[model samples]
Target: MARNRYSFLVKLPTAIALIAAADQLFLGTAIGSWIGALALGWILALLLSRPALRRRPSLVALAVAAGFTGVLAHAPSLLGWVLFWSALSIAALMPRIGRFDDAWRWGLRLLAHAMTGPLAPLLDGIRLFRARPRRGRPSSSGLAALLVLPLAMTGLFLALFASANPLIARGLTQVSLPSSFSVIFWALVLLVVWPSLRPTRWATRIVARMPSADIELPGLPQATLLLSLILFNAVFALQNGLDLAFLWSGAALPEGVTLADYAHRGAYPLIATALLAGLFVLVALKPGSASAANPAIRRLVVLWVAQNLLLVASSILRTLDYVEAYSLTGFRIAALAWMGLVAIGLVLICWRMLAGRSAAWLINANALMAALALGAASVVDLDASAAAWNVRHAREVGGRGVELDLCYLSWTGPSSLLSLIELERRPLPPRFRDRVRYVRAEVLETLVRRQADWRSWTWRNQRRLDTARRLLGANPPAPAATWPGTHRECDGWIRDDPAPEPAPSVTSESDPVANAVATTTPPLTGTPSR
Candidate 1:
């Protein structure tokens, strides 16, 4: 695989080079500007090399990159950081090499390429400079000899002089390196050196040279594949049937089982099961395997995938029902999204098996889908969405869920203000209503104060703050503590009195459980960050 040297002229590296320069130079003036500065740099690089981009990515690909960058720029959360780098990676490569055809292999190749990308050019520059002839410049061999003896003698004399004249030495050594100069020097060096780390075939060749065990395992024996499929299908059938009966049909659960608890228990684990099933399919049903060629085995595999899809759907409904019973949350929302993705992946797997598509094709297709979803999410504020859903579906809003957890809303930060304001309009007990007003007012005031500071400005916060002010007006909000309780039931909803104490229990004197309970200290409590 002799790759072209001119590949360095592609837009991907150009975009990267520009980003490396900008991030190195302009990132630290305002710490908050880091994501925005980097995002702007990426978008600029893309736009700058638009004319030169040889293989224009599909609009979907571009959207994925944009969404990944947009959300990261807006939120700056941990997820955002991961997506930001991943987006940069896919974008930087896609336009030059085109879509990756081998999923597992290409992924390894891309990783190594990124590590080596920046280092290769620096070494090349050193080599090129070393080989260049200086026609008229002095050899420096004589210069080095002339300086060696004198430099050592000067250092010796300076050391003796410094010891003799302490004040003079202190004055001479007082001039130290400036902190700002150190920052600029490193940034400048990176900016100058980054353009040299051009992408090469080194990673690709190395990955190709690596051994594979594809031929070693005779793929799960056909008899084993069939038996495994039958057993898996039966097990999945039982779970899916139970879900359809008890959950979807609204039948009562066994004593001690809440629907929310049941849903929570199965949601993530079922997703894992589906993922494992997909993996099994990829490995056991290699493209032209005897099992894949058997129509009966293919049918069984298809049936199993269908069962997995049903399980995924049940998991989704279970999550939604749980959210309705409790309240919406970021984790629950993400879990739902992930479950949906797994469901889609299962469908893709079935298609791959039926249509004779390679695992690579399946991978590329899923990657494209993931990229798009992320990009679309980036355009909206997910926290605000969660806050609004939770507030609207809350018991205060005639939903069968818990009433607005004011403390929880506070943990949601200012994103819950509008929802809190809406809840305030509802006819709540005077105490609950007052708490809502108090909390929203407090959050808005905090936002206004923070926004007033030059250092704390962010587009998302600024936009939300402006909306918060417009909705709540300029009056300063009252302190949340003014509502009475130290603890809160919701972000804005507080209790006037402490929680009711548990009833005294009558237990056997010899009961070990009772003894343990008596000795055990209660665990600590506080609201989680939303």
Candidate 2:
């Protein structure tokens, strides 16, 4: 019995390490840390697996102490390791204490068995909740209600502060948000804890039916895509503080004002553009009635065309007024054209629904158009505002010839750089290959070494810096001269340059390549790109 117990104890850590390796390969280093934590838990469980250890109150206390100590000792691995040990310890203790029935133990064992596979979805759900708690259920609703009062009060105070002193408002606008965003964050916590609070059969059935097949008809892939688009758009908008409107009444603007200021000034036009795009999508997908004999379809098409014309007119006006740039050139035009195709597809779908034509084709077309519209909207919005500060600063740093000495990059900072055109194209020195410089290397390494240290130092320090900057009305750093020069007309700078005529605006709808491809494609598909 002693030999068999010894053998089990020896094998447990190896098994945990193997699991950790697998998690690292697929789930990433952070998860590997968690697995290490879990391994520690497993070891604790093994030690407590002995009947003698279980029977002794002192040993049990020692086991718990050791588990926590291991977490602290492997400070970087605390979360994963702690969770892993806690789970195993709980598993072991459950049967020993005789609190959980055999069935409950078996259920838990089964859950543990499938834990890794379910982890991604679990994390994704957590992420979704963190992003948009308002979209989720009542468990999150309570947290939202609690937060709403404070946020409301804070917003009101900030508004009053800004109203009384515009500079204070400007400074307040710069305040860095909490590292963990509020709405989505609480939502994630709720999602994780939600299972425990899950309702009885009747309530479960009602709630389950709420997100039925029809309502979530597009399916998981499309749903995931939509969720991603919405989250990206919201994050982009919020990061830029795109809603702040200054009373322009001919106030002298400060020199070297940041793009944030520009975005704030043109917030209405930007929002209007987004709304118009959404409307265009809606119009393009309007349905028709059977008894109407295509009259409703024709009318809907006419209305859609009219609306498109109006949007185009408004966009042109906004562009001319300099309220918004005609940055809506490439993908924006394609989006409008895609909407037109969708309108046609919608008419065809309605005709099919009315005249007993194939529903499959209609479904396929609608799904395709929906995907295109979604993809287009996401790309365009991200591109339009992608050049915001964090990335712009990083680019300036690199462009100004600063060397990057980091291994891992901050997910946020690198992503921001990727959003901008100039920075993305500007090649970095080969020395920094595969290395992203966002957070300093020391900070990232320390966080990896001591996971909770992030909470103590870097995160706290950055948050404080951000808060101070906001309070002091510190503006984002200026874009380097070389950075802006990179975007200027390269063709004109050639040694044997032709005499310059008035260059066409970048937003013009004259892509010869697009037109050529459109002509070659079968009319049934509308365009090759489509």
Candidate 3:
């Protein structure tokens, strides 16, 4: 008990110092390599509080590897953040894992620790305060007595001096203190860091209190289960058959239904259906139970699961078609990845049922697949990839894809740098070319200014800056007179009518749209007129 109490005391200052470092590193600047440094600081703070973790060198190494991955990319990803925190949480709980712990229960315990970690510091402070000896004089009132007289005298003198001396009064007024946000930022940092610094040991009880994984619920009756499976298969087969006809085999849709409408509607709802089907199979047909063991039910179950897999495949195809018809975004890419996960999950469920595996095994299998996918996703820049894809296939460049959406690329910020540069190099119509340059210049300027600060610097941005310099030369395009959201569309076409302010009367015959903001708006392919 004393050891646990002392651990918190020892780590409190470290936590405070890290909070200060976080404020310095993050408050004013965009996230960059600073995240790696902050992650490393938290790891060290955790190690300081619990020396035993040093003995588990492999876990320590894994934690360091995952944490550093935050800075490994040009910019940190959501995956990197999740991986960093997850590793720290696992490292904090390493000493608590027992020899007999199974993967599923241990994972649940890890989750419990995460949910309870932020509160652990307050809990510890309460425990320590309660455990102190009662024989000591009331230290709080005595300390207040000793400081109250000095504080009163200092306040009185400061007030008198401020009124008497103009210099003092002006100096007091000039004092620029931290804002309210600083205090909130510090408290938030404490909440994030405290858990890793001192993990709650009792989180084990959360997993302990959970019902045993081995407890089997009564299985559905074999005849009823078999009938359900047959009906489900037939129903799924109908959907799959329609998908095969219209989507796979390219049969024409009904007059009113376009392929995009068909593709968009089924992409997500079908995934939900597959998920619901998997849950039904898991709950109703336990691996070693009578329903699962029966030959007829097993056959029907296999057929239904196979049909579900086909349904998943169709969903994937539909999503791809939707992307081809419209344009790809990060969300669509994620949806595709999700479809893959669902397909993998359905297969794992079937494999578990046939092999007589436990629910724990099935969960562990699915989790492993998800972790692998997230790990891969962490390093790849989905936004950049999407931007680049759109640029490469844009109709402006005479490709089969839709016209480039500069608005989306603008929202994407620096991730669109390379793609914009690519678009600039491609052959385009004169007006389209001007708009492309205008949008590209806006994105590039922001990236350059952001990287100017050390706090916002990242390897990815630096690489892009270097490549851009080589391609476009040291001179960036002149800053557009009007930004995309202001007087122009993201595609850089000028608005039909200018802002309420009068346009400058001076216009050059040689270049009417060159001073677009000062004169008349330019004519472009899709600019709508009032």
Candidate 4:
């Protein structure tokens, strides 16, 4: 049997040279920048040539050379490091290379063939220039177009920005703009003046010396549960939008405020519920035919359970005013209820996992349960919050407060916070509760701000507003504020006067460890810092 050898020299070396030249000419000679650029280029080349590299040693050599050049040319400082490591690695691989059989050699050849594309053109150019007369005129059009493209694109982007947004116009005008014609002209000149370099002949000669091989592996099931969950969530969102559109048509609610506002605010609970429900369905369906005895199945089940439990705990904490804590104005109570349902789902899943029977069926059941729980929780939170917040804000700010309140609701946009807000409306949808009581300090502050800014806002309803102002003033919002723009503006108006700071770092002798440990022997690391 004959062997094929692939040439990697031209492609690899040229790529490295091009990258090095580009970095030196444009980006400057910082060692770190050059090294980073070279590494990036090498990774790209490897990714691009992966299919071919698996088969041919010559191609691998070309790739390695290209990578090395890229590093050495761009980052000369790294040359020593690269050389040291390369020598060591080559020595380590020498034994393996020597022992490789005909099959492995064939595999290397296949890889070299795969990597030919990136190298072929450059090699062809090299050959062409080597034979051509130095003074002969060459076509410059292609080179000119390549150079002009980036500049043209950048100019168009700037033009569009200036036309669309007046705010950035001054900034745009201040920056130096490249001349498109000049760029194109320079590119053309380079194309005509530069020598042609070809790597194809070399590549062909090298590929001819390489060998070939065949390999196979058993089939494994690809998980589709994540995709299914995404699809389910999208559908739920669309449905929620339609429901809000219908509900807003009624005259009794605040004008222009739709159910979507509630949906956005309550997003956390909504997603949590949907995920839980999806898990239940997945557990129930047990889509793959793979047996429970499979280690993969066991691992997946464990992961699914753990993820659900974490999600459940987080959702519960959020509802109870721990994480993502907001005022309990709207569907906060409904969020709590949804969390309870999720808790129940978690319990059911744990039961199944412990029972250690019908693992597939139980897993599918868990998925279905998770999906339902998440879906119900999200919908409920959205409805309850929107209704309660809308009505409360409206009444607090007097009748004239409706429009601005509606605008505020709109400004919140299609986010989780809005969804939770909508969850508390009455004539409670079947299998859904209407009222919830728990409210966090943050949620209260938000409502207070809305009420204070209401179009019809007056000093008469200043009780809660006053209270919120005092609380916020005492806390003096952390330097890192979350909601900027309007929220921040609102906070400024509502927060009370700043308080004096307490002394720092004083430790009392009455502290538990201090009192007990001091009475005993000395501590392991020495006395605590004052």
Among all candidates shown, the one with the greatest lDDT:
3
Per residue, candidate 4 scores C-alpha lDDT tens digits across 379-487 of: 3334335544554544332422242233233233222222323333323333222111111233444555545443323232244346445544554323233333323
What is candidate 1's CA lDDT for residue 340?
A: 78
**For candidate 2, lDDT tens digit of each residue in 292-409?**
2345434443444334334343333333333223222233444445535534553554454445543344545555565455434433323223234223444234433222212112
lDDT of each: 0.67, 0.39, 0.79, 0.42
Q: Which of candidates 1 and 3 reaches a greater lDDT?
A: 3
Against the true structure, candidate 3 reaches a TM-score of 0.84
In terms of lDDT, which candidate is stronger, 3 or 4? 3
Question: In candidate 2, residue 413 scores what lDDT?
Answer: 28
Error of 3 at 414 (Å): 1.4
Q: Once all C-alphas are superposed, what RMSD does model 4 give against the true structure?
A: 24.4
Clashes per candidate (backbone, < 3 Å): 13, 9, 1, 105
Rank all candidate structures by their lDDT, best first, as comma-separated numbers: 3, 1, 4, 2
Window of ten residues with lowest summed lDDT in model 2:
485-494
Off by over 4 Å in 1: 1-34, 42-81, 90-103, 114-176, 180-204, 208-217, 254-261, 476-530
Q: Rank the candidates by TM-score, best first.
A: 3, 1, 2, 4
Cα displacement (Å) at residue 49, model 1: 11
